[model samples]
Target: MKAGRKVWSVLMLTLIIAVIAAGCGGGNGKNTGGNAQPGNSAGTTKTSTKDNKDVVIAVNANFITLDPHNASDTNSISGARTMYEGLLGFDENMGLSPALATEYKISDDGLTYTFTLREGVKFHDGTDFNSEAVAINIARIQDEKNNLRLRKSFAKVAKVETPDAKTVVFTLTEPYNAFLNKVAMAGMISPKALEEKGENIVKEPVGTGAFKFKEWVQGDRLVVVKNEEYWQVGVPKVDSVTFRPVPENGSRIAMLKTSEADFIYPMPTEQVSEVEGVEGIKINKVDSTIVRYVTLNTTKKPYDDLKVRQAINYAINKEAYIKVVKSGLGKKLDSTMSSKTQHYSQQNGYDFDLEKAKSLLAEAGYPNGFEAEIWGENDSETIKGMQFISQQLAQVGIKVEVKSMEGGTLSDMINSAKTPEEAKIQMWYVSWSPSSGDADGATRGLFSSEMWPPAGANTAYYKNENVDKWIAEANKSIDPKVAKDIYANIQKTIWEDAPWAFMGVDQIVSGSRDYLNGVKVYPDGSINIRQAEVK
Candidate 1:
């Protein structure tokens, strides 16, 4: 046993040294490490195509799906957000801003939200933007048979009606103050186009946004043409945009440096100096809504016991891990919901103490640590997090067998685990991306037991009557201030229970050429190319 521990310790030390060494050495210079310098105004990359009249931007990966209701992956949503129109949008600061809806009003009771559609708005197909299209889009998303994956917020939507040609009404079952924030995800689509294409409609999306869907080649590239009829009028200066999937850091950085690709979606940390020192390239960072954390399978042995879960969390040196993994770019998060959200409570922060963790394990009847599998996707961020957890947990007698799998396989492992017994895979690294900047938006779904099993994202199987009631009541709160208070309480309760060991808030980074200006870098990494023009 002593020899085993020594071997594991050496292995972990070696891995940590390797990661630090590789990070410092500039791995492939792809900007994956989140260390790139911000906005270099000098020099310019020659456009590969001889079209200086229009703008062309490049990203990693073609969109997986364009259908607003069905879009899942960030890549697809990023493309759709550009090609389609939402009632509202997040600006460069990621604050709520208007998009399709020119002006909107809430009822005195706050249950009804009425939106006045923008005039002269035309879909890519030239269909008039009106309330009918908005109504249909909402109806389709709420359809249970269709199994809309992104309908977490829309579950509260009772009905969507068009009272007038230009007026759209959203009637909620309860007064959900986050309704407008939710609308940011529910992009407006054309009713006529949906009728014409059916399921195939995703292939050709029509919206009033500044960009129009052109073509998508899976695993390779997706292209979009600028909307000449964009209702935003004078905006959308870019002529075209292309998203290419370059998983390899070396290749992505090579493309960015050589001017083959105008911009890379995420600038890795390892290549910070290369991109920053490069004359024409620029890097911008924003505090994203996404938070990385380890979701505990509370239903399974060891983790099923709150004491054990707390021990696992207490044993983690999150502050040190953040420095090592994020190179000090990431912020420590203790709440299940993001700190960027309005209702985040600082009272939930967890501190590291290996002695406390060991005592908790002993109190939970495991004087010596138990062995369990730590499952996570084979990504730089995920691996780094798991490594930290594995090393820290070892100090408290927990033996973690690290199993790295492909993203799809890891997701399947977590989703397919039906019961806590079947689902307990020691530690799993997961990301939480909230559409609405509210804790209720992300926490309610994660803490509620009803939303779990083979369906919802609550793979943790964490259930609490008090937490559930708080979430339910918060969902019904019509006033924003009231709802925020309720959610703050909910975060406190969850933190005390230690359902998850929150890691860090990732920095949303973007890279572009010197000529690209007015490129709005959203806090959640969603940017509006409407105002971006190539000089």
Candidate 2:
């Protein structure tokens, strides 16, 4: 196991100009319709009946894509995990574990990785899972023409060799300490399916996981059925899983209470108290590596000025945000990466000070703050956070118009931008979890200039030559001390640059029926249901 086991953890516009001009305010600050208290049975665990064999999970948003190699969002990653299996995977503790690959070893020089893949594994489409299958997946991601979202993670991969059916070897151009973690994150796809679907792979994902794709209704729900021939025996106890996108917090709570949903993610911190005493319902909370922040489009005016970015950061009260927006259930974010993330180093904290913010604004040549718009998903909590941001920035003379739209629409708007100049975004209230369980996962996608939109998650258009250099160095460093130092420098420099308004760290709160067993939420907010069972 020592092979690589060293490290462990939008917008929409329109209906007329009037609606756009009039900012959309936050919803009434109260849980209303979903307030029906659970019955006495809520407090006790119920035995799973035959009808309960199929589990229903309600999420805050829809999945963006099922293609594991191209997924960047948490919801999408969770969905892809249901059907895809990587050579390596993270254990419950977020440590590296063998998945499709039974064993692996790294060369002393750290330039070569040899893997022993598990035998008899088969893709959902019945394709044999062997060394060739692993090679095909790696080649797909490493292919420059594909422009896969996770291509950079495999950038150092120089060559791949499959000596036999059950063995695959990867040769790196240079030492990469994070390569194992990246492999774990890059789930394998069926070569046959890739050939058949090609670009449509995102819609038709085929893999060797516990569950096989059943159906996907965009914007509404995604359903997956258990794989009877799953490589791992006696697992995937549930017959099926249906993930419904319920953006409304109250509606999700209601579904949980009524047993319409066996589980729901993001138990909406504001309503945690409401379900605390409910019978037959359990609320699970864990510290997460997720960080909520506002990506300030650095290429845009006002935000283009470093002083303005810093001023915005100083203006907002992060503690108040945790209290009001998160209902005091989260931690104020101090750095670009969450403290739970690997190689995380606390940077100089930005305390709320209106005077300093105003002064900085004045120095940035805007004594009177300018007008701008902030965009976020239509989720209740997201809009509330954006509203709070709008109000806080207003105090610093920055007039903000808040616009919340469906998640898919917002994604289209952001990703469609071909360049920084074409990006219409000014500020985007968003959250990110480096589910890959590495410092590079947390930093590279958001900070590295090479990861700009359409290619990676760097939506802010933030660029820094020094930070980029350090990011690459940190990933390639085999020495922990060197990597840690480089990461610390990266965080410190980004913190000072203020490309983002660090908001808070998430408390991964999920609610499930007491009878739902073995379903655990990881620190990255992705749920593990491979061993989940009812009763």
lDDT of each: 0.71, 0.84
Top lDDT prediction, candidate number: 2
- CA lDDT, candidate 2, residue 84: 91
- lDDT per residue for candidate 2 within 393-441, as digits (tens), equals 8777999999998877998999999899899999999999988898988
What range of 10 consecutive residues in model 1 has the weakest lDDT sum?
33-42
lDDT score for candidate 2 against the true structure: 0.84
Deviation (Å) of 17 in candidate 1: 3.7
State which candidate has the highest TM-score: 2
Any residue pairs clashing in model 2, and if so which? 42-279, 42-280, 43-279, 43-280
lDDT of 1 at 30: 50
Candidate 2 segments whose C-alpha is farther than 4 A from its true place: 1-50
TM-scores of all predicted structures? 0.86, 0.91
